[model samples]
Target: MKKIAIFAKVHDPRCLGVAEELVTWLEARGLEPVVEAHLARHLKFEPGTEPERIPDSADLVVVLGGDGTLISVARLIGERQVPILGVNLGSLGFLTEITLDEMYPALERCIAGNFQVSERMMLKTEVTREGEVISSHQVLNDVVINKGALARIIDLETSVDDYHLTTFKADGLIISSPTGSTGYSLAAAGPIVHPALDCLVITPICPHTLTNRPVVVDAGARISIILRSMNEDVFLTLDGQVGMELKAGDRIMIRRAEHRTRLVISQSKDYFEVLRTKLKWGER
Candidate 1:
């Protein structure tokens, strides 16, 4: 609680300003502030810390950007179980819940351990060829398998555990955690799931078949997707941030990761409020 890690999007003027103010406020309160290397250059203070040195070395992380920046920090500190407090600077940030006005209050509660923690489920995805692992990645949002621009429809043969699900003739497939149900999955006609739900959502994007609908599965089940078409070029995207190209005959296995992301939350805020505000639900 005496030392904190601060991460922000240096590209955003709002984030950079708030980050400097936060460092000054923390230092005045006799608390140590650690900022990322790139962010430090834009900061009023001298550059000293790096992303690799934060979270593990500090008690908590204060994210001063939109949900995208927070998600990146979540992935980095997720393994250490360090709590992250996000300050929203982007439009429609479903993950960044705290506002600029609420920053000090949230930080006060966090340092005093007077806050709640939401454990969001993460996905552990592995791409393998001939049973040998080719690439491995973790995602906080959703794992998307889609075709490249100007490419033809890709064939994805999806299966749940031992049961053969179906062959999807579509643009792509999205496997999302309950926390991510409102993201790409929702745009693909997937249902919105509460973060407390311990389930996985399977949504097919632009499916050729009308009967192919979004399906929810137990988090414990593993999903295997085999690339069936050879001519078309497809790729795998993680959290919409990282992507990898896939060739025919590649197998992608997705399941709930053993490690979970711990997000710091204020007790007063509710999930439905966020839904209403972000989605403009029930608004005239």
Candidate 2:
């Protein structure tokens, strides 16, 4: 039997019902469903091991929730190269594009090893203080650095590949992967890039100068930013999930990670269909 891992947002009341149905379906088909440990209590069935252990044991992963749940689990499955099928239980989602009615068919395809995988690029961000690396995170979305609500405009000395790019005087800056172009980058008026493209975009939030605009750089280039202002409330955030407070003289470097998130796509679906449904493109 192929070991299939399942994860979900346990807080969502809707997941409990669907999870029970899915577990029974998997069992009847001679498939072993390994559910995340923490969600066992919420789900109406006997589950498998811890969520982190899923990456080690399972051949495939199924995520049942919104984009945030998938991202949180994706962090745990880093570098594993396991194909993930994200089912949308929340509102319209870009990552979790598959719907409830289409779940079983997608799983059947995955089990038969006939699904298409999208190798989406990920970002690696490092925080250095006084030449010492303090923290690092691998994220699927953008790395954002911004000031607190009450703080004044800050200065970030930006560079690409050991060369000085510019010193940005703005509320903040965003370093986004192509997969994240539709996220916070889009909100900052940055361009929407296809996930299949191997590149990154840097956008300035409320930049001091009208000419300082969003810039897209090659994926191989290393983008660095040094906090030039002192005694201010600044932060470095990843995937809009976790974040850390920033200090003056802090240096942040962002680049493409060695591994990418392998997303399982239905054979009947295409990227443009998802974009059109989510964005309501060309509709009157």
Candidate 3:
């Protein structure tokens, strides 16, 4: 890749040093490295680009931090389909599967054109209020509809492909992609789906009716939810990052976006190994 973009969680102390070293390494190889304006200042680099503009010209993007940071960059990527190398700076991450020690090796493989990528599905979410589209977002993880701490249990009238599904009476609801099954959905007792699968999971958070369980649907299905509760402190969150308060009668539409996130697979480990390490699977 000629122009490689670097996105990082600048707040993490470890990221600064890693980024500095990475930049130096890229320059030594006669490759161009781009950093965010804010982070470039910390690294003493001249004339850095903005985050939103990084994907416009970057041939590949490298993300440094946890899964949250990777998710943010995924959103920024939108429909670019650029390959991303995610290096975890902290604990084990689902998306940031490559650890700090593996970063250089992964980069070497990438430079040698010997890397593989996993195409992860993304969700397109649209908020419609009073017959007007207010906002739209693309998320790599789950779209959460939740009530405030003091708010009462909200009612979400859900449907699939225009077919009416059950009305979920719960603290919240999570609609996640196969890649997001291990996120909020998992914490809400939803099933863990393999990322290679093309499906969506609908999970309820503390449903009043215990029978309300998580449901998996086809990726082509058009899922929609309408807020049936009034005067409730409810909100819709995208990837746990962007959010907006929901009003009564608002319609939230979700579908598999045409855009997909391309993540560079780590050569050191497989998916099951990652699950075993992250989940502590089989540990007594």
The candidate that wins on TM-score is: 3
How many pairs in model 2 have backbone atoms within 3 A of each other, for residues 3 or more apart or on separate chains, i.e. clashes?
0
lDDT by residue for model 1 (168-273), tens = 9999999999888988999998999998888889999999888999999999999999999898889999988888999899999999999888888756678899
> All models: lDDT?
0.89, 0.89, 0.93
lDDT tens digits, residue span 1-284, model 2:
29988888888889767877888899999999898887776774564588768899989988999888888877788999788899999886889888899999989888887788888999999999999999999999889999999999999999999999999999999999998998899999999999999998999999998899999999999999999998889999899999999999999999999999998875667888888988899999
Which has the higher TM-score value, candidate number 2 or candidate number 3? 3
lDDT of 1 at 75: 74
- In the predicted model 2, the residue pairs found to clash are none
Task: Give candidate 1 misplaced runs (Cα > 4 Å).
Answer: none
For model 3, residues 91-193, the per-residue Cα lDDT tens digits are: 7699999988899989988988899999999999999999999999999999999999899999999999999999999999999999999999999999999
